[model samples]
Target: MISQVRSELTRYLRTETVGGAILLIAAATALLWVNSPWGDSYFTMTETVLPIAPLHLDLTLADWTKDGLLAIFFFVAGLELKRELVVGELADPKRAALPIIAALGGVATPALIAFVVGFGTDGMDRGWAIPVATDIAFALAVLAMTGSRIPASARVFLLSLAVVDDLVAIVLIAVLFTSAVSLLWLLAAAACFGGWALAQHRRISSPVIYVPLALIAWYALHEAGIHPTLAGVGLGLLTRVRPDEREDQAPATRLEHLIQPISAGLCVPLFALFASGVPLDGKVFGQLFTDRLSLAIILGLLLGKTIGIFGISWLAIRLGIAERPADLGHRDMFALSVLGAIGFTVSLLVAELALADVGDGSAVELAKAAVLVTSMAASLIGSALLLRRGRVHRARHEARALQPEE
Candidate 1:
C-alpha cells in the first residue's frame, strides 16, 4: 500500500497541469463541503488552535493556508519572476515590450474602472486594487490543458504579463494596504535582509541558512506594518547564484530548477487547498450578488480584465509598438484575455488586505464570493472560447499544410 501510494504521488506530481487542476477542484470541493451541512465542523477545524512549545499559536485552517503556506507560493513566484527578468523572454527589452505594455494597461484600466465605479467611497475605492492580480496557477492550468495548440509566443506572453501583474499587485499591497508604520521593526527587518544578503554572498545555497533569516524577516515585516509575505520577495531578490560566463549555460538556472518543483508541486497545491476554501453557503448567495464590493469585484474581473487586456493589446499592435503574434490575431487574443480574467488567489489576498478589520466583516466575505463566482465563470467561458478558436485555427493550418501543390 505504501508503494502504491508512492507511485500515485509520483504520477500526480509528474502531471503539472493535472496537478493544478486537481488542487483547484479540491479547493472548490472543500469550500462547498465546509459551507454545507458539515460547515460547523469545517469552521471549527479552521479555527482550532495548534500549539508549539511555550507559544500559543492560534489559527483557523484558512489562516494557516494563507499566512503560512501561501508564503511559500510567493517565494516560488518570486524565484520564477527573478529568473524570467534575468534570463528569459522578459530579459530582452524588445521581446518583453508587448506583454509588459499589455500587463500595465490591463492593471491600469481595471483600477481606473473600479475607482470610477466605487467613487466617493473613501476606503471602498481602495478595493479597486484588489482585482488587479492574476492567479498564475489558474492561468497556467487553463493554458496547459489546451496543450501544444497554443503558440509558444502566446504562452510566453501570458506568463510574462502575469509576472508583471503580480509585481504591480505587490507594490499596491505594500503602499496602499499598510496602515501602521513601525520603525524599529522595519529596521530589524532591514538588518535581517542584510544578513540574508551576506549569507548569499558567501554562496550559502542551502535553505537552512536562509530559513532563520527568513523567519526573522517575516516577523519584522509583520511588526513593521508590511505584510509578512513580502519577506519572500525580499529573500528571493537577495539570494542568487552567480551567472555562468559560458553563453551555453545558465547561472541561476539550476537553483531555479531546484526550487520550482517545490513551489509548484507542494507549496502551490497546499495554498490552493487553504487559500481557496471559502464557505460558499446559502447565506453567501445573497451577499455574493448584491454587495457593492462583490459587484465591483465580479464586474472588474469579468469585464475589466477582458476589455483591458484585449483593448490595450489591439492598440499596441495598431500603433506598431507590437506586431500581432504570428499565429494569433485579434480573435485569439480576446479569447485569452477572457481567460486572464480568472482572478483567484491574488484577489483573495488583496481582499484580505482591503477589508482588514473593516465594519460588518461582510465585505471580505462578499469579495471572496465574487472572486469565486467570477473566476469560475471566466474560466469556463474563456476555456470554451479558446478551445473552439484553437480547433478552427488548427483546421485552417492543417489544410494549408496539406495543400502541397499550392
Candidate 2:
C-alpha cells in the first residue's frame, strides 16, 4: 500500500512538473507574441468572441480561458484538497494545524501589505487579494525539478500550504467578484450540487451521470453570478476518495489521474497563453515602481508571502501547536515558505476580476505584469535556496548509504 501510494504521488508530481514547464513556455510565448510587430494578432486572438446563445453566454477567448479553462484547474485543486483532508496530511488535526495557520498567514499578511502600499488607490480595495494565492502547480514543479534530494515530507508540506492558501483565494474570488446573485439560478446550482452529493453517496461512478450534472451546475452558477468555477470545486470535493473492496482507486483519485493532465497541459497553458499577453512597453515597466498598485502587488508577493508563511510556521512549531515533519529542518521550512511566493495561475485571474470595473485597462495590465515579474523572481530565488538545501540532504543520504550495518 505504501509503495502504491508513493507511486501515485510520483506520478502526480511528474505530471504537474511537466505541466508547469508548459505553462511557463506558454507564458513566455504570450509575452513575445504580444510584443512582436504583429502584436495585434495576439490581442485579436484572445478577444475573439464565441457566442453560446443557447447557454446565454457570449464570451471572449480570454474569458473562456479564464472562466472556463481555469475552472478545470480549480476542479483538480478541489480534488487534491479533498484527498488531503480525507487521507493526506490534513487527515490529522495535529498534522494539519501548521499548514492551516501558515496558509492563513500567507493570505492575511500579503493582503495587509498590498492594502498598506496601495491604500486609497483605485483598484486597491479589490486588488489586495491578488497576492494571496500560491500556484501549487508551478511551485511544486519547481521543487520537483530543483529539489531532487529534498524529503518527500517537504513536498507534502509545500503542497499542503499551497492547496490551503489557494482554497482561501478561491473563496475570496467567489465573494469579491459576485456583482449580483440570481436566486433562481443559485437554487438550480444548489440542486445540481445536491444531486452530485447524492450520486456520490449512492456510489454512482459513471461519467455520463457526472459530466452532465457538472455542466449544468457550472451553467447555473455562471448565471447566478457566482463564478462558475465553484461548480468544479464543489463536484470535486463531493467525489468519494475511499475505494470500495474490489476497487483499485476511488472515484476522486481516478478522476484526478485522468483530468490532471488536461488541466495542467491544456487548460492552464491555454489560459496563460491568453492571459499573460500584457502589452509590454516602457509605461508598464515604469509603473512597476511609480504605480502604487503594481508596487503593492510585487512587494506583497515577495516580502509579505515570505514573512507570513515562514513566520507563522516557525511560531507554530515553537509553540508546540504542531510538530514539524521529520527530515525537514528550519532551513528547509524557510525555503518552502519562499516557494509559497510563486503566485501565478489564480493571481492572474484575480488581476482580471479586480480591475475589470475600471475603464482604464492599463491598471489591469500593470497588475498582471507585476504578478508575472514577481512570480518569476520568487521562483528563481526559491529554487536557489531549495537547491542548496537539497545538496545538504543528498550528502546526508549518501552518508547513510555508506554507513556499516549495525
Number of the top lDDT candidate: 2
> On residues 1-406, what C-alpha lDDT tens digit does candidate 1 reach at each position?
2343234223322444554676688667768766678777766666666644343346566666666666766776676577667655577787777778888887887787777776665357578987787877787788777635766556667777888888888888889867888999999999999998887666555778777888888878876878877888767766553343442223244544566566666666666656555766677888677666677777788888889989999999899897676688688888878877888778888887787676776677677778878988988888888788878878988999899784
Model 2 TM-score (2 dp): 0.97
Candidate 2: where is the Cα deviation over 4 Å? Answer: 1-5, 401-406
lDDT of 2 by residue, 1-406 (tens): 4555557667777888899999999999999999999899998999999979987799999999888888899999999889888877788899899899999999999999999999999988899999999998889889888887898888878888888998999999988999899999999999999999999989888889988999899999999999988888888898888788878898888998999999999999999999999887998888798889998999999999999998998999999988888889999988988889999999999999999877678888999999999999999999999999999999999999999999
For all candidates in order, the CA lDDT equals 0.73, 0.90
Model 2 Cα RMSD, Å? Answer: 1.4
* Cα displacement (Å) at residue 324, model 2: 1.5
Clashes of each: 2, 0
TM-score of each: 0.88, 0.97
